[model samples]
Target: MPLNKQFNKDVCRNLFAKDSRRLFLKRTLNSATITLAVSSGLLLPIQAIAAWNEVAFAATNLQTAIKSVLGTDLSRASDKISIKIPDIIENGAIVPVTVSSTLKEVSTITLFSEKNTAPLVAQFELDKDCIAFISTRIKMSQTSNVIAIVTARGNNYSARKKVKVTIGGCGD
Candidate 1:
């Protein structure tokens, strides 16, 4: 180990080489780790992160969008749910919207444009640790009612605001 000594390739190979026993042990440990992770539910599919509902986003009207998204035709208007948007939007391509709820156990927040070809604009699923708030810019076809639905405690609460658009989105 002297600083002046040249390194020996043969010695290094014998000391640190991937011999048959080492290779087999390494492979077995790796396989066991993977098996333990999957079997114990530490590893999961991508769907657990976020799942898309194609039917809901494809609904063309308010009632149908509600039924498709929430699996129900009824939702009560609630003061606890607050939707913030412009009274008039000069451009409908990017209308800013914010939805927040003071209600407890809020699990999901959905946005809808009442007159859009597909009324459903956005959907969000909030985990237990998340706050009940979402903000995003959505495209609008024309002057329409923007709706926000907050799902909490196995019920849907909603709020709506009318946005007047001077310029149309969705290819005028």
Candidate 2:
């Protein structure tokens, strides 16, 4: 009721007091309320945020295409993007690939196969309502890196994978 002048002793005595059923239930309920309050507070902000839908880039080679689009070098593993292609490709003319990104606010997906005369195989601009994903057949003259560049939240992220072409499609 009134401020305890001996704060330490008063607090300590209450802390060491015998536990009661009501106190336990009250403590549990307080914790649950706090948890609900914290989670709802957290979820509101995350849901309020809006995503993006535009990415752009340029390149001389597949590696640099990744850097030009993603702003960094890509890793064969552990990148935010994924590349789907046959490890051993027999026909270089029609090598299928799919690039999908998990990065938020993804706006574009581009493909580059270094062995082609024009390293930039394809470029896609997605609508705001669209997802950051695409698949297409590309021509790879020989063994080369297929790089997937994803733009998200006004930043670039990329991933790459190498494919072996047994025969040359470029007539090399």
Candidate 1 lands at a TM-score of: 0.71
lDDT for position 7 in model 1: 53
lDDT of 1 by residue, 95-133 (tens): 999899999999999899999999999889899788999
In terms of lDDT, the poorest run of 10 residues in model 1 is: 2-11
Off by over 4 Å in 2: 1-78
Worst lDDT 10-window in candidate 2: 50-59
Error of 1 at 55 (Å): 1.5
RMSD in order of candidates:
9.3, 17.9
Report the error of model 2 at residue 138, Å. 0.5
Whole-model lDDT, candidate 2?
A: 0.73
lDDT of 2 by residue, 55-147 (tens): 323355655655655556643443778899999999898898988877777777777787676577666778777776788888888898887
Best by TM-score: 1
